[model samples]
Target: MTTVQATFDSVDPATGEVVGTHPIAGPEEVQAAVDRARPAADWWASLGFAGRAERLGRWKAALTRRAHELADVVHAETGKPHADAMLEIILAIDHTAWAAKHARKVLGPHRRSPGLLMANHAATVEYQPLGVVGVIGPWNYPVFTPMGSIAYALAAGNAVVFKPSEYTPAVGRWLADSFAEVVPEQPVFQVVTGLGATGAALCASGVAKIAFTGSPGTGKKIMAACAETLTPVLIEAGGKDALLVDADADIDAAADAAVWGGFSNAGQTCVGVERVYVHERVYDEFVAKVVEKAREVKPGTQIGPITMPAQLDIIRRHIDDAVARGGKALTGGTVGARFVEPTVLVDVPEDAAAVREETFGPTLTVAKVRDMDEAIAKANDTTYGLGGTVFSKSRGMELARRLRSGMVAVNSVISFAGVPSLPFGGSGDSGFGRIHGPEGLREFGRPKAIARQRFRAPLVLTTFARTAKVDERVEKLIKLLHGR
Candidate 1:
C-alpha cells in the first residue's frame, strides 16, 4: 500500500479562490533537498565566477523574458495588483543580473597589504561559497524580497533550497522552475513547499546558511532553531518603519510619499511606512495633503487586499484601539472582510499598539512634533529598525543618519530597495545580516585569508630561533612606525 502525501491550498486572498495545491514537505524531504544540493554546490563553485556568471545570466534572461508569467503567479497568490507584481518581478530581475555580473569583482580573490612587520609575506583574502544555502521567504513582495538572498547566494556559487511562504509557494516554484529551464544540470536551485514545520526543517537541514524574512517573533524562533545546529542565518524581519517631515520639507511631496509609502502593497511591506512624524509648523498642512492623496487611493482598485486573512483583524484592532484612546481618523478607517481602506490616525498615544506594534496594514499613525529633534527621537523610539524616510531639503542626509533603521530614503520613499548596490537588513528587533550588494554577496560565503612567505625575514620575529638582537630591532622598528 502507498501512502498519499498531504497537500494544502494556496488561496487568493481577494476572492478566496484556490490558486494552487502544494505538498507539505517534512524534515525528511527537506534533508533530501539539502543532501542533493551538496554536490551541486561543488559543481557550481568549480565553475569559477565567470562560468557561474554565464549561467546566471541565462537564468536572469529566462526570468526577464517570461516576467509576465511569473507576475501572474505572484498576483494570484498574494492578492497584489498585477502592476505591482510586475514591478516586483522587474526589480528581482534587475538584482539577479546585478548579482551575476558583479559577483567576480565582489567575491574574487584580492590582495591585502602585508604591513611593515610582514613585508616579506604576500597576503590575500577571498570569499568562498558556504556550500548550500536555505532561503525562507515571506509572502509579501515574494519575488523581490527573497531574490535579495537567492540571487546573491547563487551568484556567490552556492546551491539553494528555497522554502517559499506557504501563501506564495507557487511563486517560489515558478522561480525554481524558471531557473531549471536555464540550468537543468544539477538542481542548483529548488523549492520545497509547506508551512512552519517545513521552515524549521530547512533551518535544521544543516545548510551552510539560512536567509529568512518574516515576523520578529518568528525570527526569534528561527534563530533558536538554527542555534541548535550552530547554523548561521540571515533574517529580514518586519519593521515599524517611519517617515519624518521637517518644518521646511516640501509638504506636497512629503504627503505624496507618506500616502504611497504607507498604503502601497496594502501596507504589507516590511519596510512600508507605518508611522509619520510631522513638525508642528506644518502638521495640519501635511495631514491635509496626505488625506487628499489617500482619498484618491481606492481599495480593490489602487490597493489590493490584505494577503493574509488574519491581518484583517489586526488592522481593525489597530484602528479601534487608536480611536478608543482619543485618536481621530483623518480619512479612511473601515476594514472590509478582505480589504482595508487607507486609514490615517492622529492624536494616538505613543504607547498605543498602533504606534508601538507592526500594524502590517494600509494604515498610518501621523503625529505632530515640535521640531526635528522630537521627530528623530520619536522615529527612533521603536524596537524595529528596518527602513525609514526623511523629507527635508537641507537636513535630508543629516536626519536620515539619525534614524535607527538599516536603510533610509531622503526626499523619497523606499528608494534604497530599488538600488541594486545598497545592502538591506535591520538591527535590534528587526533582525540582522544584510542581503544585497557587496555585503550581501559575502553573507552567503566565508572569507579565506592567505599569507604566503615570499622570502625569509631579515629580522625573523616569528621563529623560536630569533635572537634578542633581532627582537630589539623589531621593537625599534615598530616604535619607529607607530609610536607617534
Candidate 2:
C-alpha cells in the first residue's frame, strides 16, 4: 500500500510524543476541495429550509449519539479535560440545534414598507443562500467555536468548506464525515486539512464568505486576503476581556468565575478573562479571594498543557515582562516543559505586556479602580472587544451595556454562549461580523428583495411614456406625503 508522509504529529504535550499524524493539503488541493463543493452547494440550496432542517436533524442525532467519541478526539488533540470537552461538544450541539430550528423563521420572507409613492407595489425581503461558505477554525474550543459558523451556514442553505485548526484536524474530519453519513448524496460539507497556507487558500478561493477565529494579527491577514476577492468575512479574533467587580459584588463568586474563565482550556480562549478591574472599596478583599481561589487550581490537575507548544514562550514572555516591570505574581507564574503554571499577577503596571496584550495562557492581571467609570475606561482601553463579564449587585446590566464588547455577562461569565440567541463577534481589533443568533444565520445568506406590481398607479413613474399630467400628480403626491 502506498503511504503519504505525515504533515505534523499531534503530541500528547504532557508526554511530548506523537499521538497521531494529519495530512497537510496544499493550495491546489484546497482549491480542489472548494471546487468540488460548487455542485453540492447548488443542490443543498435547492433543498430550501425543510430539506436542510431534516438533514440537520439527522446530523444532530448522529452527533448526540457519538458525543463521547468526538469529545475524546477533542481531549486528545487539545488536551482539555474530558468534562470540559464534553461541555464544549454539548454547547456545540445546542448551537447546531438552535441554528436548525431558527433558520426558517430568521431567514424567511418578511413584509417591508413600500413607501407612499410606491404603495401600488408590494415589497418583501428574504434571505437567500450564499452558496458556499468557508470556515477557518481555531484549535481552542475546536468543536464549539467552528460549529458556530458550520451550523449556521448549513442552516442558511449554504454548503461549507471547513478548515479546522491544524492541531485538531481530526475533529474537523470527524464532523464532516459524520454529516456525509447522513447526506451521502453529495459533498455538501467538506474538510481541507492543512496549516495557515490552507486557510489563506480558502480566503482567496472566492467563497461567498469566510468565518475565521484566531489571533488578531492573523485575523488582519485573513481579512486582507479576503478583501482581494471582495469576499465578506466574519472574524472572531482574540480578546483581552475583563471582569469587573463592584463594591457590593460577591467576591467569592467573582473569584471563582475569574479562576475558571482564566484557567479553563489552559487559558486559550479568546473571551478568557485576562484582566480584572475592581472597585477600590473592595479591592483588597477581591484580590485575596481571587488569589485563594486561583491557588486551588493547578496546571494538569485543573487545567491542561498548552495545546500549541509555541504558545508557551508567549505565555512566559507575558509573565516575565509583568514581573520585570514590577508586577507581583500572587500565585503561579512559572512555566514547565509543556505546561504553564496558573499565574495570577497583581500590582502589574497598566502598560505591562500582560495587561495590554493577549497572553493566551493561564494568567490574569488584576487592578483596582476608583469607581465604575474608571473600570469601564480601563476595560475599554484595549483594542479587543470580544467578551467581558461584570459582577455588580446594582449595576450588572448597566455595566454590561456600557462595556464595548460583543457579548457581556452581567452576573456571570460566559453565559452568552449558552443563550444561543445573542450574537457573538467583536469590534475594533477584535474583528467584526457575527456568529450565533439570527445575525449568524443572515451572515451566511444574502438579502433578496422581491417586489411586484399590485395595481396600476395613479402616477406612472417606472415607465418612460409618462405624460406631464402624471408627473404633476406624482409631484403633488410626494408633497402631500412629506408636507414640503
Candidate 3:
C-alpha cells in the first residue's frame, strides 16, 4: 500500500503570508537523509584537507556572490529586518571561511612528546570526523547559528543532515542548495524540514551526534530521545543573559549596548540581554539614559515583528506579570498583534517569571544593586548561564570571570559571538558542549592518538619474558621517582 506524506506551511509572521510549503520529513525521510550522509561522509573524507578546502572556498564564494538572496529568504521566514538578516549571513560566511581555512591546521596530525617511559616511541594525534552529524537549528538567527556546526562539520570531513527550525525551513533550504551548487555530486550538507517530531526522528536516526539549539525544556526532550540510543548530543539551549553596568561605566555606551542587546531582532537572540543590573549610585542615570534611547526607536521600523505568533502571548504575559508585581515600565511596554514595542521594566521582583525565566522577547528588567558584588550575585542567580555583557571601565575582566555564563563580553555587547576565534556555547541550564572557534571544529571530530616505536628496548617490560628482578628494579625506580 502507498502511504500518504505529511506537509506543513511556512508563514510570514509579520503579514501571515504563506511563504512556502514543505514536506514534513518524517522518520523514514529523516533516516534516508542520514543514510545518504554516511556515503557522502566517506566520499568527502576521501577528498582530504586540500580538496575539501578548495570546494568549500567555492561554496563560500557562491554565498558571497548572492548574499542578498539568502538574506531575503531569512527575512521572509523570520520577519527580521533585511539588514539584520544580512548581518547574520555575513557572520556565518566569515565563520565558514574560518572553518575551511583552519580545518587542516586544527584537525591535522600533530607531533606529541613521548613520556620518559616511552622515550623510544614517537607519538602523534589527529582529529577524525564522526561520519554524519545531525543539526537541529534555531529560527531566530537562522543562518549564523546552524552554520556554526554545519560549516565546521563539513570542514572536518563529515557530512551534515540539518533539520532547520520549522519556522524557517526556507532559509535552511537556501543554505543547503547553495552548498550543493559547489559539491553537486555528493550530499555533503542536506536539510530535512519539519516540526518537533522530525527533529526527534533525526535524534534517533543513528547519526554520529546531534547538535540542537532551542529551549531547555525541548532540550530535555531531545536529550531523552537521544538517550535511548546513547547518542552523544550538543545542546545550545535558551538563556536568561544579563548585562551589568558599573558606576564608572560610560552610561551612554552602556545604554546603547543594553538597548541593542535587549531589543535587536525582536530580542529573540539566545545571548541577548534579558536583564540589567546597575550600580545603585548610578542606577537612576542608567535608567534615564536607557529610557531616552529606547523611546527614540520604534518597533516595526527599527525592530521587526515577533517571528513566532505563540511567542507574542508569552511576551504579553511576561510584561503583564512584571507590571502586576510592582514592576514599572520605564518605556515602550505595549504589545501589538505581531509586534512588541521595546520594553524596559524597573522594580520587577527578583523571583518573578519575567526576571527568572527566559522571556525571549524584546523586553528587559533592570534592577538596582548595592555594589558590584550584589550585581554579580544577582546576574549569576539565574538557572540559565549562556552569554552575558558587562559595561565596566575598571573591573571589566575581573568581574567577567565571576559570572557563571560560558561567554562574557566586557565593555561591549555580544562581541564575542562575532569573533571567529572565540568558542560559543553555554553552562548549566543553557546546555553543554560548544560551537565556533577551535572548540567548534573539535566538536565535530574525534581525537585519534598514535604511537610508533622508533627503536626496540634492550629490556622490554611489557613482555611476559621479563624476570622478577627486572620488575623489582622497575618498582624501585618508580618508588624513587614518584614517592614523596
Candidate 4:
C-alpha cells in the first residue's frame, strides 16, 4: 500500500508541538481530482431538488450529531476557545439547513414580465444549476466561512470541490467525510488539501464558479486569475469594520459590544470592530467604560492565543504605530509568544497604518467625532464595507442604513450573521456577490428564461408583409398609451 506523507505540521498554539499532519496535494493531484469530479457532478445534478434536499438533511444530521467533535478539531487548529468554535459550528449548521430548505423557493420556476409589445407571448424564468463549484476557504471561522459557499452551492444542485486553508485541513476533511457518509452514492462534495499552490490549481481548473474567502490582497489576485477564464467568482474578503457610538448611546452597552467584537476569537473575525467613532459629548464617558471593559478581558484567560503566530507582529506594529503617531493606549499594548495583549487606543490619526490598514488582532482604535454625520463619514472612508454596528438610542436604524455595507446591526454587533433570512456579503473593495439567504441560493444557479408565443398578434407586426399603415397605427397606439 502506498501512503501519502504529511506535507505540513499542524501546531497547537497553546503549546508549540505538532498536533497532526495533512497531506499536500500537488498540481497533478488537483487536476486528477477535478477530472474525477466531472461525472460525479453530472450525477448529483441529475437528482432533482427533492432528492438533493433529502441528502442534505442527512448530511445536516450527521454534522449536528458530531458538532462537538468538529468543534474540537477547529479549536485544535485555530486555538479559539471551545465555546467560540461551537458557535461557529452552530451557525454553519443553521446555514446548511436553511440552504436546503429554501433552495427550491429561491431557484424554482417563476413567471417573468412580458413587455406591452409582446403581450401575445408568455414568459417564464427558472434557475439552472452550475456544474462544479470551487470553494477556497479561510482559516479563521473555518466552518462558517466555507459553508456559506459550500452549502448554498450544494443546495442549488452543484457539486463542490473544496480547498480549505492549509492550517485547518483536518476540519475540511472531516466535513467532506461527513458529507460523503450522507451521499455515498455520488462524490457530490470533495476536499483537496494543500497550500497556496493547491488553491491556485483549483482556481485554474475548469470549475463553473469559484468562491474565495481571505484577505483583500489575496482576493484581488484571485479575481484577476478568474478573469482569465471569464469564470464567475464570489469573494468574502477581510474588513476594517467600525462601530459608531452616538451621544445618547448607552455607554456600558456599547463598551460591552466593543470588547466582545474586538477581542472574541482573538479578533480574527472578518467583521471585528477595528475602529470606533464616538460623539464628543460622551466620548470621555465612553472611553472610560471601554477601558473598564478592556481591563476585565485578558489574553489566554478570557481569549485564546493568536491562531496564526505571525499575526502577533502585525498586531504589535499597529499598536506601536498608533502610539507613535500621538495615539494613547489606555490598556494593554504588548504582544506575547502566542497571544496579543488586549489593547485600546484613543485619538489615533486617520492616516496612520493602524487606522488605514486591517489589523486582524485584538486591538481597537477610538476617535472622537463632532456628531453622527462625522461618524458616518469616517466609517464610510475605509475601503472595506463588510459588516458594522451602530449603538444609538434613537438613531440606530438611520445610522445603520447610512453606512455603506452589506449587513448592519442596530444597537448590536454581528447580529445580522445569526439571522438566516438576511443576505451576507459586501460591496466596494470588500467584494461582491452574496452567500446567504435567497441571494446565496441563486448564486450557485444560473437564470434560464423561456418565452412562448401564445396567440397571434392582432396587428401582426413581426411578419415582413406588414404594411406602412399598420406600422403607423402601432406607433400611434404606443404614443397614446405612453403619452405624446
**How do these models rank on lDDT, best leading?**
1, 3, 2, 4
What is the full ranking by TM-score, best candidate first? 1, 3, 2, 4
Estimated TM-score for each candidate: 0.99, 0.97, 0.98, 0.97
Cα lDDT for residue 469, candidate 1:
93
| Total clashing pairs in model 2 | 1
Clashes of 3: 0
User: How well is each residue in 28-114 modelled by candidate 4, as lDDT tens digits?
Assistant: 887788887888888888887898898999989999999999999998888888888999999999999999998888898998888
TM-score of 4: 0.97
Score each candidate by Cα lDDT: 0.94, 0.91, 0.93, 0.89
For model 1, residues 1-484, the per-residue Cα lDDT tens digits are 9988899999999999998999999999999999999999999999999999999999888888898989899989988899999998999989999999999899999999999889999999999999999999999999999999999999999999999999999999999998998898999999999999999999999999999999989999999999999999899888999999998999999999999999999999999999999999999999989999999998888889999988889999999999999999989899999999999999999999999999999999999999999999999999999999999989999999999999999999999999999999999899999999999999988999999999998888877998889989988988998899
Q: Is 1 or 2 the stronger prediction by lDDT?
A: 1
Off by over 4 Å in 3: 1-4
Q: 415-445, model 2: which lDDT tens digit per residue?
A: 8988889999889888999999999999998
In angstroms, give how far residue 111 of model 2 lies from its true place.
1.2
Best by lDDT: 1
1 versus 3: better lDDT goes to: 1
Which regions of candidate 4 deviate over 4 angstroms?
1-6
For model 2, what is the error of residue 277's alpha carbon versus the real structure, in angstroms, after optimal superposition? 0.4
Question: What is the lDDT, from 0 to 100, of the residue 158 in candidate 2?
Answer: 92
Worst 10-residue lDDT window for candidate 1 reads: 457-466
